[model samples]
Target chain A: MFENLLTWLDSPQTLQAIVVTGSLLLFGIGFYGLLAYTRIIKILISLSIMESALFVFFLGLASDPHKTAPILGDLFKNFEKMNDPVPQAAILTAIVISLATMSLGISFAIEYYKRTGKNDIAQMDALGEKR
Target chain B: MTGFITLFTLLSMSVVALFSLRQSNLTQSVVLFSGVGLGSVVLFFIFNAPDVALTEAVIGSGITAVVLLIGIRHMHKEPEIEEVMMENRRGIRRIAIALLVLLTLLLLGKTLLGALSVETSNAGQALLEHAMQAGAANAVTSVVTYFRGFDTLGEVAVLFLAATGVGLLLTVEKGEDAIYIEPNFILRIGSGFLFPLILLFGLYIIVHGHLSPGGGFQGGVVIAAAFLLLFLTRRRFGLSHKIVTILESGAGMAYVLLGLTGLWLMGLFLGNFLPHPAEKIGMLVSGGIIPIIYILIGIKVGSEISYVVEKLIKRSHDV
Candidate 1:
């Protein structure tokens, strides 16, 4: 049973599952931090963790076991059709949007730091109370 | 086969997750973050989106890391990390986000459930069959141009919006610049070689867009990346700002003008007014307006991205 499990783990299908599993783990940590963590910056990091995990999960779902890069040439010549390019297009769009998000997130971090000199959500709340 | 892997994967993933979750420090969490990015990059490849995988590899791993590192460095100085022990966690917010996501997924799934196969898809089969007539070798390119040029035009609008918004927000705020701008020998050397290489590749991607997988957006981003290399190297590369602005506006203006000109010449807006003679698919002059549109998109995207980054950096003087 142990040997079977190890062998299975080595397979691409298993590898993909493992990837999603890691992503889920990330999502959990991020979700917990986003909710329970008291620091604003830490929460942001947690959110990022969650974001990356979801990214992995989505990408993993897009992969096919016997597929190759959707490029044209010798490999593609033998194939009936290339794998769906829609996911690639969609993910490419997502990547760009994520950059914008990060840029905006960091900007907010800077602003938050400037205003509070503290990056904690709890501390931020105290300041909010002060105001 | 898939079931066993899925089960095992879930098990292994939980172990990794537990490790990350049990970790006491914020720094460890961030380090673990990259692991997730790498895992996803692999998944993207599996999904047959090498283009997406490449983008994820570059931006998700590269630029995202840079942003996070900067954020973390600043965050370390603050005592806020230890101060939070709130009674109420944002469970409500989480539920709301989840519900919204579920709704979106359900809607999307429903929409796709009844979708036609590629063979029966009107746009897909038409482009595949009549691609030669459209002057585009690639069916995708044919669809993008003759069928969906309007969407490409809208994408240009979005790029312009990003540039404009960032430009307006920054307004060339004064601050110490050179001290803030990170520089390195490798960045200089690699950038020097890489920019032109990337630019060359972008042109190839755009020019040959009709024949292959790449298109205006991908090629345009590459061109912007080339410009980014200059920004990293030259610090004050004095990027002929006016020329870039002109190019950006000109490309967009030209697209509209091209469309309007078609209306004048062919008595229809965006009409194939000057459609190049569709002699042979995949040839230089083939794909009539596809190549021209791509070229315009490359210019527009390159300029807009550069403009956005420049605006965000605030053009502060070195202290």
Candidate 2:
């Protein structure tokens, strides 16, 4: 039984499984926060968390146990067993874009507060809705 | 083994994320969120994606956390409406949400397990084989700056839009003075000492992008971070709007002109128009137009983010 456990732990699939489970749980936590939080800032934070979870999931799944980084050098020549570069590039773009969006959302929230003096989403009834 | 370490990091990251969301203080929550970013950097490194790791470390943990904290600082403290909502929520509704989330996660897990059995596509391998054609040692850099260069331009445009929106929304009115807190001697002296070194390091990262694990985005954020530090120390210091605007717009226009040059020389936009011999793969002056494009991106991103940071912290007077 101990040897079986050891073998399972050694496998690349085991690491990938752990990564997926962790990131999904992280996403669920963010989802719960989005539903539960009333503050616009908290909701934005949760949304950013969700985005990070997806980034982690993509990069984690694209990786392999045997491969090194996808950079050629004297010690490690060629891309024979390198981790996928596509996902890394994609995730790099996503990270920057997400930062931009998060900051934009936060600026909107700040403006909303400055103009209306209300920070809670429950209180934002600017468009003819009775609060 | 590496797998075990990665597993531990993943577990710790999830725990941090949960705790960050559960924190009552917004500042504390932002700090905890940065902790989550730190974990991700570790995971990225372990997974052999050092470029992503560096980007996450600089942008995710450093800049994003600072931006969130400044955002909280900009707003006045309010009563805990969330607590009231928690108390007023019906037990049945709460239970329903809890169960639904669990069920959805279970379904996702099952799908993921099934999908794991299928073979990953060979697209990445094909790209890897062509990565040398771009004359970059780092495959990720070549893929980002050469293979999918147009997508990166779009991403930069999105960042520009965000910066513009932030500037439009957060413009401080005339005659309104910024609230400045005096920094202590240690912070003032230390930040002054570290600023030049940090800027130099960011330049190094940008210049060596094609041969190393970092590129424009990561280095750009690092440069912005140095400015953030300077902002923290000084009271009345302000980045000249004209200079920053010129730097950002000029870099952007230069990027497009370079792309047009490629389109004119080669049939494809943003193509490697210059000669990039395979023998020059690991050299600094290699990668044809890629290094030059990255430098432009670095300058643009650095200037833009620093401008955003300045606007956020100072609520600057100049519109």
Every candidate's lDDT: 0.59, 0.83
RMSD in order of candidates = 6.5, 2.2
Whole-model alpha-carbon lDDT for candidate 1? 0.59
- Model 2 lDDT tens row, B1-319: 6667777887788789888877888889999999988999998988888999999988888889988988888786665464435545456448746885786577557744666553442559899988878899999999999999999998999999999998988887742535456888988899889999999999999999999999899889899999888888887677888999899999999989999999999989997899899887888899899999999999999998998888777776683
Chain B TM-score, candidates in order: 0.71, 0.92
- How close is every model to the real structure, measured as TM-score? 0.69, 0.94
Docking class of 1: acceptable
- Residue pairs with clashing backbones, model 1: A39-A121, A40-A121, A56-B40, A59-B43, A62-B47, A63-B46, A63-B47, A64-B46, B135-B287, B177-B317
TM-score of 1: 0.69
Best by lDDT: 2
> Model 1 over residues B50-107: C-alpha lDDT tens digits?
5666666656665555556556654557473354555455565477457645654554
* DockQ versus reference, model 2: 0.60
**Looking at candidate 2, what is the lDDT of residue B116?**
52
Per-prediction fnat: 0.35, 0.56
Model 1, span A1-131: residue lDDT tens:
97796776556544544554455555665666566666655566566667766766665555554555444443433223544433444456556666666656665665566556867655665345851
* Candidate 1, residue B315: lDDT: 35
Give the C-alpha interface root-mean-square deviation per candidate: 6.8, 2.3
lDDT of 2 by residue, A26-56 (tens): 7777777787777877888889888888988
